[model samples]
Target: MNDRSRDVRSIRLPRWGRVAADQGVVPWLVFDEEGKAVEPVRRFLIDFVARDNRVGSVRSYAFDLLRWWRWLRVVEVEWNRATSAEVRDFVLWLSGAVKPRSAPRTVSAATAGTINSITKKPYLDDRYKPRTIRHSNAVLRSFYDFWIELGGGPLVNPVPLARSDHRRPHAHHNPLEPYRAEGRLRYNPKVPRRRPRQMPDERWNELFAALRSNRDRAILALAVSNGARASELLGVRGVDLDWGDQLVRVVRKGTLAEQWLPASPEAFVWIRLYQEEGPPLDPTAPLWWTLRRRDHGAGLAYQPMNYEALRAVFRRANLLLGTNWSMHDLRHTAALRMARDEGLSLRDVQTILGHAHLSTTADIYLVEEESQVIRRVQDHLAELKKRAQLPPPPVALGYQASDLEVLFGGDQA
Candidate 1:
């Protein structure tokens, strides 16, 4: 056993190989000696997120796994050796310490609820909202699956750690449902205050004035005119623009729909300016680049600006304008202006917003005609009153008051 241990240690076997040997199995699979199972998992996540163009989600998952990795290190357990019980304990630790410690500004109940829901294990308290726990569950499941595929150790699936009924009725307590009632397993619907829509002309002027760099200006123009999501905007490339037709192609996430948006004249101008001044304007170069800073000096390869950079610009602009708004709110502002002021149909708004469903566009851009319902009810009441005012048909000759009383009640008598 001592000689065998020395041989195993001296071979400089890969991480997965070590895991397999520890599990009493001979290692045959070839893998990187230095690169562990998590390394491939990271690469896979990077490619998967990039292909899906979900930069925010990718970053979030990366951080989540990083936290898990840190916890594993603190516990002195090799990641490959982690069992379901250890995972559960870690989740509990995260629910009590990590989440509360990390989000101190949140309400106590809300924070507790968040921790419970995010972990999704009923063994832990289920009071919080479920988004973070659900996300963590997905990340961990994927990580373990990848580890197993790489021959790390005995395959242990963690998804069944939480019991959830998939086919429960809407009234049943289910956390996944969006419109769940209070005291149910899901979060209560938030009643958002309706802010008056921004005037298009004012927004346009402010956007132009706030954005000085060609790239920033172009981003604002594209977002306003095309009503593209941040991810869609980030995915745009130089070749996607058709200057002649004033069109820009975007790869919409979820469906991977390639959509060509009609670029307004203003959009065309800004796009042209960005093409000239930003990045190299190569066909494959990103449409937006970070503004060069004097401290960074010249000739350094300019990094492409991501979605967060675009959001920062919007945040700064909102601060200057004294508005509690975001870049997404700008899209809403554009949709509202187009639907209400430009006299655009819901379908037109749908096209502008790249909505796969027209109903979603309608909900966002079309205001309910409040008076229409009242008018209909009023018209119905008026018709009833008119009928009531009509004289009774010349009562059949010799119809007695007693007969009328029998038909119309004591008042007629």
Candidate 2:
């Protein structure tokens, strides 16, 4: 056991790998199904952090690369020599297709890797959702690019057809993605960009009205008013708020950095009320829950309210709301309200939302072009007309078609 452990330990590791070993982080500990640490996988993940990628991004990339590893096996191609055609087929598979027969959806072991990871239910389904396809393609393309850069057998990236990139992200000020003179990679798949979901005004009003607890009201108000994520709002410590400046410093989720988001006047009032009713002030202490009586009196002691606690609040409030909403809808609601109602510019919205790129901000909060609006209206009207012209559906029978003859003994006809 010691010799085996020594062999695993002898593998040269980067800084992130050492950190993963010490911390036992799951995402950073990816290995093949056979429990062998592939050197390429190890180096790629380490490089992900070397490029200063966020923890969440590294985790996602790890999973995507795992799928790619499985794909290599199914294609009967070594990882070093995969061609562009296989990459294209992988992307197409992710976009899903109707089956030809009572044909089992399992096309290949590689595809099954993706399908099983994505939903796992629908046991044999080979279909990939458009969103899933897009995400998978991105990760795979990036992995291939990295492999080529590492001089891993192939000189060409094999992720073909770069010309279809209409995602002409305007030269924006993201430091991580500098203007590549040769241009960045893009896959040409048409996935519908769905609008961000927001709570309707009526539902929003009903939800707030249902909140009888000061803490619940304050928690939700901060989320909506500031466009802060649930974790950001939940992570608030007393020191993070500057009441005089009407700003709350949140350690933004995913991107671990503090950002001062402006708070509504009502937010300040409710938060203060909740704070007063709960524990006494300690700047370093989490502003949310108080320590239980047994755990009290410890310096800066706290028990920050968890996701389930906040979820329970929403679940109770749901009884009064005609519709349901998650905590994230608050962020979306704020984003839309800022851009559409308050006339905030894209750059300003980006700043408020802590988005890394202006293109990301633009994608979410797009104003339809006149032609697009007209086309949408036409489609909607056509749908209405189609519904109006439809014949009523046939009434359902309590018995099956064969049961009708069997139960009634109706050869009498």
Candidate 3:
């Protein structure tokens, strides 16, 4: 048999159940007093996810555990008695082995380093970027957290393990820091930097024109007009719209807010046309559905479209417009237009955009036009000229002869 098969067969799971990792089959394993693999970790993981109200989270955790189990079997670690250190090592192995299929150009060096570090002590390399190390550490941390929570081992957070910066004897030293002086390393928390929000108006019009389908146009229009987030738009149902009031009930994050927005008559006409000709409509069904694909067999699915789909749409829009524009920029355009053209207050713009803070709304969505600035400068210059042209102030009232002589140069005036 092959090495993989040999490894799989050697695993001694308890009578409770054994999960078939090879086939994605999770079996319940029950262990006795003498540490033996009994049931599959899948049952426990599934139950845990269900209990935590995260059914979607189980598949990912299960996938991670399966790889961990395979490594443990190969390394001859007693699954029941696996120490925190062993769990840590297993996690490092998993992170490196999982290849990202999407971006083929990039290789996961951090993952490889993590695997090598756990398996062999002398494999440390100084060239690993801080960001890469942090990501590998996070994957390990998550795996250990799951392992501990399942009653398989003692509760130990692996974050500390991955985060610890201990130098190996043979490892190359960083130029910035000496090996002897390397201090306790704490993982830096990741922070997302905000990008400039608004795009040029010409690009916006071009994108709008490029949208081929009525549904696509309507989605973009509503998102731009109402300044709604992708999630809010995805969650929208047919019933959320009230034609009489010209309002839509939007759920932002978790809070529901009613927004008053007037749709153009043409836009309203398109929306009605979409309802009649678009995906089959149930009152409770998602307002947006996948554009029917022949390969997928043509019926509307209840779940709303994903973020990737929205991104693909935006990418297409950008290609057509000959400019890059993100979905958030649409909302920004709406806010800026309201502030500049509609003569709305900052607070009013904030309300329209559904921003939690007025400052954040202003900082991102408000655009300062060069023309407006130039106009203000010109007005200031005109005022100054008018003031300069006025007659000189009556020689300050009390004119003595000597003062008058000094003012008029040679003699008294």
Candidate 4:
């Protein structure tokens, strides 16, 4: 038999799974513990790519399907035989189980789920967040939907919608009203809403002092001033900068539309310094380049800065400051400052932040700080105490105290 046919015959559903990305036409594929490609999963992923979904999305779905396949192996259920019970059990397992650590732990387990003092954010532990479980449910539901339509897998979708009645989902829902939770997928975990944590000015200064180079400084300045996403900032090219206008052009995420955003004068100054110190730049070259070089076949050459490189810069600063700050934190800091400190309107902030909807910007940046609320509450309590300690007011100027008391009652108190 041919190699392709021979490989297919040797494939079997394994207890543990692996996700692999091919350098060929296929973006991603799943394999069993025995290193045999799961034909069903391969086909599904290929179809997903053909539908114009992102390659990153394909990778995410492949991992989710791999997890589902592993769970199926444990229960000795074939893919087509999986029921709602299997999906429910999978979510339950994810809820309680600690995620496997890819490397040795550096932080103590006691610190898990606690608020970090420096960053003012929660310390993440080795467990799947509720959002991840919900996403997995969605991936599984979509996967089964694709198969059922082709008449290859189970007749009905195993991952069913969370329905309140037998009626169709969203059958009579009002367009203006918020979507009800009953319309969501069954077995999906409820993800709690987390407010974005902005860095305090003092902590921001400390982080700035820890940066190793002017390139990182310029990056931080631009990010904190423009509220651009990390990826969008990294995508900037040398030609995209306008020194006269003090603006930088970035391609917006999701929309891919180019937008020119205003940046601080200090950011442009730092950019000039960084560019002066670094290698000579071509107008078409990437604005941000790595300091170090790696051999790319011919010889050692500097590469354009990517998300990972930008993250590493912050990682080093975080290490020095004893904080866990991400690149996105700068965007939060900028948005909060614009909305709260600078007295900018929500619409203005939304435009700068590149949010598709005004409500998104308002919901994230318009939240009252807990500390500010506590201070106001304390002041109110103090005022109430002062009023309570004051003596009774004197009788009206026109009437005697005894006469007023007799008119109302012996004791008006």
* C-alpha local distance difference test of each model: 0.59, 0.67, 0.57, 0.83
Model 3 — which ten-residue stretch has the worst lDDT?
115-124
Query: lDDT tens digits, residues 1-413, model 1?
Result: 01111121122211122111112121111122353445544554644554554544555666666656655555556766666655555555544443323344433343332322221212223332345655676677666766666677445543333326544334465577575322222211223434334444655676568765777777777777767878888888888988888888998776778999876788778777776765566688777777763335655667777777777786576556544345665576577767776666778878778788998877655774334456899999999999988766655677886788788875343
lDDT of 2 by residue, 167-260 (tens): 4334365788755544433455767655675566776878899987778888888888979988788888899999998899999776788889
Deviation (Å) of 192 in candidate 2: 1.2
Q: In model 4, which range of ten residues has the least summed lDDT?
A: 1-10
Model 3 earns a TM-score of 0.50
lDDT of 2 at 235: 83
Question: Residue 195, candidate 2: how far off, in angstroms?
Answer: 3.1
Cα lDDT for residue 213, model 3?
A: 81
Total clashes for model 4: 0
Model 4, C-alpha of 105: deviation from truth (Å): 0.3
Q: How well does candidate 2 score on lDDT at residue 175?
A: 86
lDDT of 3 at 189: 35
TM-score of every prediction relative to native: 0.52, 0.62, 0.50, 0.83
Which has the better lDDT: candidate 2, or candidate 4? Answer: 4
Query: Model 4, 1-413: lDDT tens per residue?
Result: 01111122233334477888888566888987678889888888878888877777889999999988877876677999888777776777787766666576765466777887867788788788999999999899889978987999987788888776777655788999996656688787777887876788898899999999999999999999989999899889999999999999998886889999999999999999999998779988889999988788979998888888988897788767778888888998899888986667889899999999999998888998766778899999999999988876777667787777889775533
Best by lDDT: 4
Off by over 4 Å in 1: 1-60, 74-130, 145-156, 161-208, 213-215, 255-257, 272-284, 290-303, 308-312, 322-324, 335-413
What does candidate 4 score on TM?
0.83
Q: Which ten residues in a row have the lowest lDDT in candidate 2?
A: 1-10
Clashing pairs in 2: none
Off by over 4 Å in 3: 1-48, 51-99, 102-151, 161-185, 189-192, 251-269, 290-309, 332-413
Candidate 4 residue-wise lDDT at 401: 77
